[model samples]
Target: MFRSSALLSLLLLAIGGYATPVVREPSPVKLPFAVRFNNGTNGALNIIEADRARINLIKEQGAALAEKHENVHKRASYSVSVTNEAVTYIASIGVGSPATSYDLIIDTGSSNTWVGAGKSYVKTSTSSSTGKSVSVSYGSGSFSGTEYTDTVTISSNLVITKQSIGVASRSSGFSGVDGILGIGPTVLTEGTLSGSSTTEIPTVTDNLYSQGTISTAAVGVYFAPTTVEETTNGELTFGGADTSKYTGTLSYVSLTSTSPAKYYWGINQSIKYGSTSILSSTAGIVDTGTTLIYIATDAYNKYKSATGATLDSATGLLRITTSQYNSLSNLVFTIGSKTYTLTPNAQIWPRSLNSYIGGSSSYVYLVVNDIGSNTGSGLDFIDGYTFLERFYTVYDTTNSRFGIATTAQTTATTN
Candidate 1:
């Protein structure tokens, strides 16, 4: 299992780079009830509640933000099932009832959300451990499950109605997750299955948008600490877009052929340490499911060189000068044309394990960790925690393409 500390600290993702990154300022909108969550030992994200002025600012900017990205489509919304004890979202399918859901890693890095099937057969065969080898081959992880499809359903008061769905490939850890949810615009449906024979392996985001499982076409996600008791961790809004719950600004990032799905969002334009700009125009992805922000090789090198520390490249993770990281000012991102900035403390990531020479153990040292390439076919461009929690965001898909908006959250919106 991926450790909480490891998962929370860095933006570990695949690499894909094409265009130059943009830089800008953050939306003036502020969310009600400051999002309070522990960042483990390093520190917690001390997000304060937004003031009345900020709220008014968001209202003023809402329309222009909405009108900015009129071409982006709202991807698919998914049904999350609790098969085992774990939570996973649905991916895509191959043949037969491809609608059946499988355990997936809800990743914002990769635009495509896919599932694993051990030596696959008909829809009714028992799931075997054959996927263990497959997992090891891909990322040294495997899946376990049994072939079983059941009537699945998900609903939200903000959504159209109770949404019905299907589930298959019941597994222990693999199927435990409702299936991975990729919070990007491009659905991973384009490229033909490269190494595998799976044909229905569309980008999870694409399939969800293409399918009518969720009413509104677009979706929204709000995550709190595991301690906060709630039936749903976040909301995936469908059909209509709600401004009451978001800051109401939909920033965008241009996509390239290498971009996952047909198009991709979540690209970061810049990052800063104090007044010093480290990554002037770097590419990145915006993933809510990811706890930490991941950076590319060049950016990581520049940051580490400036800070005078060596970061490991294997895992795109980081542990900078704890005090410097905590004290830094706004960490910025420039999407398509708009720029969004987060307070400095938000960039402080916890070092899960004690640092040691490379091993599989979580006990790693503290230093700026360098990730893989973000140049080609990478999720490194997606933005994560540093950006989302501060604003009330909406995925507006009603007009084919989608854009984000800063919303005004009066009450805790439930999923």
Candidate 2:
């Protein structure tokens, strides 16, 4: 069944490989999106507008999950590379033998790789039609197309032969990019094909592991907190965790058993405002596609009250004065046995980029917001980029565990 969320999405792509996969460090590649400032870059996101879009997007994702079982099972399109357009991260990849290069979005939310949002998918000597139609609908975008198995290459050492790829016959909601490189769970591929309802297509990460491209059937994600409009500050390590990317001990948490949330890289975690438990452990997903930290409505209310923040319609984020900022406490997340902290400085949007998000230079906006629902709704919260930028995340499909660790950005006061 298909579930969706809106706004702020990009698909990721990589080099395709067909050889016996080797266990090498699959380092994360830099997206074209510049974390630069003072330029009309990063899709020039107006904070207020982006916040509103993101709110609706997250709600769509949550609601879509709720309606999943009622609807016919369907898979969504794969990840796209992120871009400089404040809302996305992008990657450049090749399709076809003579390798037609394309820039794609990076997505972790959905899995089903395809192309032709901007540039069309080129059929090469390696292309072979699977004779099955494919379709997926993201909240902000959707695509319908034919399936093809082709020689995919990620790098010199990484390549997958006969990888299933969607050649979009129709698509929407993508600009300046091609399509997604979905590395989501293999199960998501279920019901994506027109006639092959029971078939499960392995993801890029899956191919890397099943074919021995990496040591483990896992992917490690690292994104740095950025003040600039763009930065190649992110890394994706295939197979195993990169000890150099993190500090202290890496804590592993099991995927939440909750429906819908469990469909993705979901987990059970509790939130605390310093010493007080604002939201007890609940089912939620960690989405690289999402942009902010979102809690259930009740938890949001408690958090807002605790922080003395007022809603700012202009930015779709909570607003606080300098005094409130000074009084902000450490917002802690208890996952597994480890406690990850989002310090006071980490809560507010960077003062330097307030105008970009359509806020006053003098005022500060909180990155934490409402998910449009309350706790116990199966899925409760989303630890988006705001949270990921501070911590490194590893998705281990083989072991069914999600790992998190502290990064340099964890203690950064950049915002």
Candidate 3:
């Protein structure tokens, strides 16, 4: 899994920016799709090795995102499942009239809905090339290909007419999957298309809302904690959130205006480890493409010191003793007017899957890590899958705000 910088992330899904999802009918249309996580491998690397490599790559992608500001999944037809392949989330989607199925990575960090990374793009009566060259630079890979408008079928009930898609003639860094189903903001597409620097291609969600297939330009994402390589523990809803997937109120926060991060689904929030402050209110993003909860270097240091965790070379994650685990405090995130908590049990890596990442079964690994810089950077923290797994998130493009709420997994000790 490669990460894209700035507004350009996806299709190796460098997984960076998405598009503007606007609103239409007051009535919401529910389109459930299928999302699977790929916890499989990359050539010779096992699941854990692949995860570490992917994690390291995302750091590079984040740095690149800060520098370039451009490049940068789920189910439901309304269904989202996560399988473990390359440690990235994959979504199964259909394109063309006959509805050929393709497994694309579900990436909220990007908005380009393209295909042809692994499976060849199938052209039929519904496929039309727009004559525009599409390209995106993921930190570890890149792709440049022709652009096309095609009929996209997420499910029998949800179909998008003339959706913009990239068909890669040449691609590197993606394996076992097609291109990304970018669901990020529309602005990020500014400089991505070759020969069309200022052109903005409409994303799948953008078309869904515009077509009145859904009431609003929003997508609800749900992820459940897992220890196995694959499971149907994820869900994606288009148009509006699935009220059944979350508990309590779905609090909303306006997107942050900070640079770099502002180009994506950015937000502002603060963090605390128990009673002590760890990270001050700062701007960052919540990403489905990212796999961990990363904070600025300074905050990470404080967390490491607070928990007395030592860096584990084998897994590239922090390790703690049983005693430390017992004494660990809840890590709380304050976003907008609400505070969400990550219990100690929720902070540790899924213990049952320790061996997958080359960690001892008895070892306790912490998922929170450093973003390689201090706080105060335009983008300080990234609430990755680790954080999202404990909460239900809503990307409301219509109102220009994001939503978050606790879920059944909020305090799960399954780890």
Best by lDDT: 3
C-alpha-based local distance difference test score of model 3:
0.75
lDDT of 1 by residue, 1-415 (tens): 2212111100112123446432221121111111223221123221111111111221222222223334333222222222121112232223222234333444343333324333233442322222211111111122323222222212111111111112224323232233333444443222213344233233323333344333334454444322231122333343333343455455533442222222344333566654677666644444443334446566666666665443435333443454544444555555556655554433433232122112223323222233344433223344444345445344443444335544332112221
lDDT of 1 at 105: 46
Worst 10 residues of 1 by lDDT: 3-12
- Report the Cα lDDT for residue 343, model 3: 99
TM-score, predicted candidate 2 vs. hidden true structure: 0.84
The per-prediction tally of clashing pairs is 76, 68, 63
Q: By lDDT, rank the candidates, best first.
A: 3, 2, 1
Model 3 spans with C-alpha error above 4 angstroms: 1-86
Q: What is the C-alpha local distance difference test score of each model?
A: 0.34, 0.73, 0.75
Name model 1 segments beyond 4 Å from true.
Answer: 1-151, 156-216, 224-233, 252-268, 305-327, 350-369, 374-380, 385-387, 391-402, 405-415
lDDT (Cα, tens digit) per residue for candidate 2, span 322-399? 988999999999999889999998888878877777679778899998877788867688888889989988899989
lDDT of 1: 0.34
Q: Please estimate how well model 2 matches the true structure, expressed as its whole-model Cα lDDT.
A: 0.73
